[model samples]
Target: MSAVHEVAPVVDAAHAEPYATRDEYAGAIGRIRSAAEAYYAGADLVMDDAAYDALLARVAATESAQPGWAASDSPTTTVAAGIAGGDVEHSTPMLSLDNVFDGDELASWAARLERVLGRPANGYTVEPKIDGMAVAARYVDGRLSQVATRGDGRAGEDVTVNARLVAGLPAELARPVTVEVRGEVFMTDADFERANELRTGHGGTAFANPRSAAAGTLRAQDRAYDAPLSFFAYAVHDLPGGEGLFHSAAMAAIADLGVATTAGPMAAITEPGVTATTTPTAATTDPEATTTSSPPAGMPLCATIDDVLAAIESLGAARGSLGFDIDGAVVKADDPADRDRAGFSSRAPRWAVAYKFPADTRTSRLVGIEVQVGRTGVITPVAVLEPVQVGGVVVTSATLHNFDDLVRRDVRVGDAVFVRRAGDVIPEITGALLDARPDGATAFMPPQVCPRCGGEIDRSQKRWRCVRGRACGAEESLAYFAARDSMDIEGLGDKVIAGLVRAGLVTDPADLYDLDAESLAQLERLGRTSAAKLVATIQGSKTQPLSRVLTGLGVRMTGRSMSRRLARHFGTMPALQAATVDDLQRVDGVGPERAATIAAELAELAPVIAKLTARGLTMSEPELPTRPAAPGSAEALEAPRLPLQREDGSPMTVVVTGSVPGLSRTEGNEAVERLGGKSSGSVSKRTDLVVVGDGAGSKATKAEELGIPCMPAEEFATLLAQLTAVRLG
Candidate 1:
């Protein structure tokens, strides 16, 4: 129940302005609006939630100082800062709850409620505040009719079509009575992983967090496949059969009608003598939906403020194991009479207050700033921080994303800076705690030349990249070239590649083929025997198909699958290099931007490609029956379909997980493609088959859960061999 200590304001922070001037105030307003819109739209958020709250607090303080200066459209006067707009009006305004950061604040809110009620509240209900998008589901005769988002608390966009796919939100309630259920729509951890897998498999970027995934999935229509979503009702807005019920009682009723409430698994902690009541729910047949069979730990019924705080603290402690994100705890007057007495404010209800936990962020000293060159030559500034625990991980370094973000945050070496584990995964420097800055702390200077190759910097994009691209990151490119999924060169690990780069023995991947055992043995640590093996492995890669070479090349905007696609489409390196952007786009999943980037990358790597060709390396893909004659050329007739083709000639989406007997993961994927199947890394509803191997882990379990067909690795290997033998004949 202890309150997190307050942080002193930073003097040099980007949002440090006091907003005393009109221009400064206006700037803050604009920034808040932009951030809110991006957040609601499930786009990349400009600032973390903690930073946004701080900025909003500053604006609030300023507005309170000069009440006359506040405008009608001021963000303080609107829900979500007035960013959301929609056509569907809510039956009642879905007001947001005011936040309480500490026990003292919580006490003050309770006191205010007591004053309004003219007596102490009979009871309080505390529930975990699910971190998700808010939506209102309208039911007619106990059947789900429409679902809308909580846009501006007044109206929202209709999302009934997508909502029908969500789990926990039953299509029909137990009783055939009308009601408007207000709840948070969210993705569970498993759902997020599955969703990301599905998105990336389709050549789309993964969502940053579960909240973003839930928001995007809930709003998306016409998706090729449904991403799993879960719902938990917090309020029943219009209950036809139930009126003036206590808040806790209403939640219990909602649960009985086959809806999951925030009570979740922990089931509510009851007062000393009261036994928790079990809520009834109908069994669900929907595979994509979440089902709750246990009685919701009823919103712990709290008779006192201390009891409420205890319930909140208990929920916070169990946060990590909840299997979903809960940003805070919501405390509300349980008695309907008390809520009526307290009434509502313009923006939020007075009967409820949210006690937000300190965000998964901490302050640590920025010991140093190091520039790391990415595989694609993007220069990223990494903050070397004094080890600090964030989101349960000891974070020693955090990404600054780019120079612009580094500058915007104004983080300097030797300063105590704010580090947040973005999405509970990647540690990122959100901003600097400038008030704690040490004397003589200096700002970081962005590199004018590429850190690795000293090449010219391309400042055209926000992410600073080297003009030489992959060539500037020769060490990375060479390692990638020798990777298991690419050239399958066993002896050329990162250390060996680094030695080659450092000794000036290799400037590009092609140079690896030129190293003799005698020349390689001269490096600091390499023995003659090891060098010979390395040389032999390098030479062996020359026999690999053009698809492997293309994969090794690290072409921009392309991956192993895209390389395979390009190799299968063009067959020869010369044909691919000569293809225009339009020709590249003709391949599945490639758009104009990606095609143009690939075209440019191929052009830049022409000299290296020629070197590989001169070395007698394979420059052509395996001869397939369906290779295109030319871009946009009509096929004389449909070429014979391979064994793995579906009835309509489309390739089956096959996922190969774990280790296949006698075949590497790369080989397994290649075999799938050769047999006329599209190999996918993730298992989803759309996946036609899963080839399970030893220790297949989660993907195997996921396949079983989804009722997808699975074949043993040995069976798949035998089938692939038969297909390959038939193709060769």
Candidate 2:
């Protein structure tokens, strides 16, 4: 166990002064160490990396100011401590890299190193800081011996069996030399998706992100059932070393031993206003250097700070194209001797620092809290924030998710809060800075009554809802009903819906048919011309197919595709209204729970359906050619054949994926349906065929795995033509 204590002071203020006492500094150091241990253990983080770095900097500054008061085993002087999972001790400490947020900080670090050396340093090496789980692998006599995770800097969990199963990690080295190699294990975005699909298929919870997926897979006891993971060597240590090689040379040596590194040769960083000298390092001076296998190609060398910045920029630009995730880039001193002279800090090497890219999180003041009623009548709280930029977008509002989250985060009006763009969209308040909170800022309580309709609130469930049902969420429902994929009602938007709801002119979708130019023209912003156009559009919507009408109804768990399937299965609104739960469940993708929900929603909306039907809306499917019975045929006597039925006299289950030439994905699914086949969004064992199109990804792979027949777009089109001809004939 590491002697460094793991606890840290919580600095809740954004601009609070540094620690004034040794106790305060010690607390901050302990907190940082604890957070790092949790992070390495794949547990929930108490604070984000930005906050962790701030506290770490404070501890470092405090130690520098009063060295006599500093503990001998302080976190600042030790590598990250290990957790209890792994029993294997590392030959050398796996130090965590210190981080700098921007170019200025990076330059300052570089300048500090040069100043310590009393002259300009030789150069620097830059590489990506892959966001993944770190592990050290030991090779004995060119054979795979053992692998351990970075449990704490000194010891890690032994995971040799699991490590051997990773796709890209080499099981054995080419040469018979005892060595230890350190690298990261990660999962690509594509692998993460596949892993989630497999997990959900087997009734398991899906992982939240790629890094978590990789970590969980590496640590799982059942290695055979774990998801696929990849590895990349970043550093190497020879057991019987003669001399230390340059960082780049060490990476090349690992690559030569049949292990894959993150990328080829590191980018070289030259000092400003100086020309880079092409001096060969010790590893390159070996007699067998020309004969030794070269590293995998395409790692570019950068000269000067501008060049390094450019390299970072280029990497950022190409981030989306990479198969794996990287949170930052590492800048390391190129000269091995210079690194030795700079020496090691307790937790990190002094010669290197990771330049972390700007995070998606930003601080903003909470101006107010607003309640919004969702289409399902659930009341959600939203934070109105003073406009702030996060993840390159200006965000004005963030979601509090629910009343529980609102209170849990303790976010209040006038409080400074940390806002982050979740998944690069959907701004959310991660936490509030209590130290910077205003004196008058008070806790916000969710309204007992619906904010929009003054309806009674039901707090019996985790998410509170309005007892008035659709009446409380009428505007939201109206907007969804008018959406392009739903009813496709033109000239009707949020503003129009709000106006109609405020004027009491529209209470439900059925009320849209009752609207007229005179009534609409009376609303704010709607003039004579606009009102006439809107009325005309509403009138035209009466001719829309049953699928659109079902989507417009806003049934829970029923979207465009499901609506279309339900419409096709029932043929008409009357048939659907009369369907039992079992009958509804017979449709593809409609399970028992969904069937129950659909049945209950339909039962509740019967009156609305009748009103819409009475108002002249189309409630039945369009007529299609019915197959004629063959003379004296026993099959003909049983039932009429649907237009979508296959020649074998059964409904074909087809999965349509990606974009098809000459037809949208929607059109492709509709084409399958028109021929009496069931169209599904996902490929499964039940699927009879998969219609693959351009950009077809995981679905195609799954179909191949299941041995389901796949057809190209042209073949599908040809099949559709044949089916149409046979149906018509």
> Model 1: per-residue lDDT, tens digit, 291-395?
222223237888999878767765665554455666788999998988888889888899999897766655677889999887778788889998876655788
Which candidate wins on lDDT? Answer: 1
Q: What is the lDDT of residue 55 in candidate 1?
A: 67
Q: After superposition, how far is residue 308 of candidate 2 from its true place, in Å?
A: 2.0
In terms of lDDT, the poorest run of 10 residues in model 2 is 280-289
- Poorly placed runs, candidate 2 (over 4 Å): 1-17, 81-92, 115-123, 140-143, 151-155, 172-179, 186-230, 238-260, 264-300, 313-327, 334-347, 357-493, 497-729
Best by TM-score: 1
TM-score of 2: 0.49
Work out the TM-score per prediction.
Answer: 0.54, 0.49
lDDT of 2 by residue, 1-729 (tens): 101111133342233355799779877777776766656654434455446656766776777777777777676566553333468988888888877766777778878888888876677777767778889989899777999988757888898877876654677666788888888877765566566666655665455345656777778776346666777677778744526777777766666676767554422212211221111111111110111111222234544665566556545544433545567777777778888899887678888888776545556778999987778687888899988765557899998767865665567898767665522336767556565667888899779788877879989865687898777788888898888766788989999899888888899999999988999999888899999999999889998889889888888767777787788778899999999999998776576667887898899889999999999999986643343224235674455655446554566788888777777666787778776676766554557888888899988987776578988878888777776677568
| Deviating ranges (above 4 Å) for candidate 1 | 1-367, 385-396, 413-442, 453-456, 466-472, 494-503, 524-532, 623-640
Reference-based lDDT, each prediction: 0.75, 0.69
Error of 2 at 100 (Å): 2.5
